[model samples]
Target: MVLNVAVVGAGVVGLSTAVALQQRVKNVKVTLIADRFDEGTTSWGAGGLFRPDLDSYPAEHQSSFRQWISDSWKFYNALASSEHSQDCGLTFVAGTLLQNSPKDLGYSCISELTHDFQKLDEAQIKKMNLPSTFKYAYSCTTVITHVPTYLRWLMQKFRGNGGKVECRKVSRLSQLSDDFDLVINCCGLSAVELCQDKSMYPVMGHLVRVKAPWFKKFVFSDDLYIIPHNDYVLLGGIKDAGNWSRAPDPAKRNIILSRAYAMFPALKHAPILDEWVGLRPGREKVRLEVELIKGGNKKTIPVIHNYGHGGHGISLSWGCALHATRLVQELTSGLQARL
Candidate 1:
């Protein structure tokens, strides 16, 4: 018998999981359901940089978090090197990360996995046009994804592989249990309501995309960053936890532009292409475990949660999707054995 799987959420995590599922599982039908897609999702507005915070997860899961970062890096690196890099919106860019102190400079988790990770000297910083206030900095090669374009590419790839997408909101998990053999929840912040998870909240982020093709590399300091894509550059942002509003605040946009312009004087007069506000699903820890949902009439469905990735959704997507795929395989195998 063919297994039918329902993946909730069409964002990066959900779509990635669906793609991975179809690629790895045999004789399976996968459907992606979400209320929004492409530009309507938070992933669309992301800078799409591949920098994972080493401290994002708890101490016990640190090893696994590092593995995810490594896997994600490798995945994006391979994509960047492929002939379809431009079409897939993947590009390798070198950048400098500045900090007030050297103690806070390095990401120890996957530092070894990054390309050309090195501390920068004062001379190097001056040459890079960084402010003199920056006492320590590091340079590394990282991948950046043009999110809007990339999401479209992912959707096309998924559809081409026989996966289906449904544009609808899921009010409850029980509603899907009757039809699907398994349900994968990658609903991001919506998991708070869908799973009734109090641990999940929103982290409001604001970014401005401007026409600045000359800005060749990424520059990050504190919570602010300047990420350059093919046609435009992304200037961001603030991380206001517990803020759920998606409305773009004009004052906040001005502040971001002001700070970014201070760092790179050339951005002072760059034409603004678009402004965006997104709510990143923040949690104490990302939930990526399996649960069994028992329904009426002696029926049950396996749910593998893959949400609460917060700002690192794009960074950790493929890695977490691969992990989710493994969980699906194990759950299916166990079910088959029981039958």
Candidate 2:
């Protein structure tokens, strides 16, 4: 018995959920329906660093932080070490977090889950070509997924596994109700209007892409982060909540470039590749739950809401996807037996 499942949105979270369900569930046909894909998505501009700031989530949501982070790490780290990692934009990177003051970043989840997690010594910090203003730093080895490359790879993998994709906007979940037995809503910020979820806000963000092949590591600060990808370096950014404009702000872009130069003087010589602006789905915590949409004739279409990950989308994608997959399995249990 084949269950028809439709996944809304095409970002990392959406694609991850689509792939997870296709691989985890039996006799399920997944059709990825989204308005955007690859570089067109907000996840495309993400730093792609697999680090989670669990403190960003509420206390109740923090309970699942460890499980999600741990599960995601295992998923990506395995791909990072695989033979075809380059094809999938998966790679391991060592990064340091610099702070002016010792503030708890809720590192408990990553601290216990990551392999090379520890505080850096003064000597090690001094060796970096960064400003001397940092008071403390934590060194950790984490996996990074170049979003654009990874998204394309995920699409390929999804299609390879008999999954389907449709490039279009979904006006309402009811539209999919007649066709799909289940719908997984990973529409990110659009969920506000799509699901009538007023709690979701848009966190406008800015990013600058630079050609800094000379740098091999990543750095993080209070408001700025520098992530080195294979061919370019991702520098960013500012989080302006409630701002929905997709256009890049020149003033903010200039300020970020200036700050990046101030942090690492060498970036001043590196050529700027591109600048981008997008919105993150801002919510108190990630929404990963199931809802029953009653349609005509008393038919119930189970919808699994998986969005509101904000800046942690790439980090929490697989973990939350796996959780959502469990819900799909649960909803289809009786149907599988009957069909």
Candidate 3:
């Protein structure tokens, strides 16, 4: 008999989990349930950079966070080498971290740590024609994701593997428990209402996707960044914590564009393709755990949560999905052994 698994949410985390589970777990039926799909997800507008900000995880799960990130880097790195790299929305771009302080997580993590990461000095800054007072910089090779293409490819792969994606907005956990024996919740911000998690809130992000085929390098300036990819150059953004508004505010848009242009003046010439607004499914930290919830008539269902990715969903999706699959395996194996 095959184990039936339902993955809640259709964002990067959810879709990635479905793909990984189908590949790893044998004799399993996977159903991906979500109210919104494809472009409706916050992952659509992400810059998809690889370095993980340590804050992407809850404090209690810090160790696990490090492990997940390490595993994810390896996982995606292998995928990038494959012929399916484009389908996976993975590409290698030389990364530059420019900030005045040592507090920048990317600088700290990638610079002098990973492959070809080096700190830039005043001479190098001048050579790059960077801003004055930009007292710190680091250059390294890193991967960036094209979320739209990647999500579509992932969904296709999921369905091709005998998985089902149901388009529905779940009002209660009972609805899921009624159908599937196990549910993996990747509902992101919706998890706030679904799980009644008070710690979850929206970290708003505004991005401008412009056609900048001429631009290939990635630039990071404070919270604002200008990352160029194949389809469009991603200009981002602000981390407005506790903000629930999804509408793109003109003032915020100006701020984002201005900051990005200040870093790369040439971006002013790129035709504006679109402006995107998304609420990062932020929690005190990302939730990647399991729970047994009792529904009507004393029926218990296992739920594995993999949401609260904040702005790092694209960067951490593969890792989080891998972890969720492990939890699913544990759940199913325990039941099989009658443990």
Relative to the true structure, how large is the alpha-carbon lDDT of every model? 0.86, 0.87, 0.80
Runs in model 3 lying further than 4 Å from the true structure:
55-60, 104-113, 337-339
Q: What overall lDDT, based on C-alpha atoms, would model 3 receive against the true structure?
A: 0.80
Q: Which ten residues in a row are the worst by lDDT in model 1? A: 102-111
Write model 2 residue lDDT over 1-339, tens digit each, in one string: 889999999999999999999889988999999998877788988889887877677887687866788899888988889998999899888888887776456776777777988877778788865765687888888888888889989899899999888999998787787888889999999989999999999998888999989899888787888888999998986889999898988999988888888888889999988888889899888889998887654667889999999888999999999999999888898657655
Over 1-339, each residue of candidate 1 has an lDDT whose tens digit, in order, gives: 688999999899988899989999887899999999988889988989887776556777777777777888888889899999999899999987778866332376446777688887888877876554888888889899998888888899899999988989899887797788889999999888999999999999999999997889898877689899988899996999998899999989999998897787878778999899999999877799999888664578889999999888998899899999999888888766554
Provide TM-scores for the models: 0.96, 0.95, 0.93
State the lDDT at 275 in candidate 1: 90
Judging by TM-score, tell me the better candidate of 1 and 3: 1
Q: What is the model-wide C-alpha lDDT for candidate 1? A: 0.86
> TM-score of the candidate numbered 3?
0.93
How are the candidates ranked when ordered by lDDT, highest leading?
A: 2, 1, 3
lDDT of 1 at 245: 91
What is the C-alpha lDDT profile of model 3 across 60-106, one tens digit per residue? 77666666677777877787778989987888889677777754553
Best by lDDT: 2
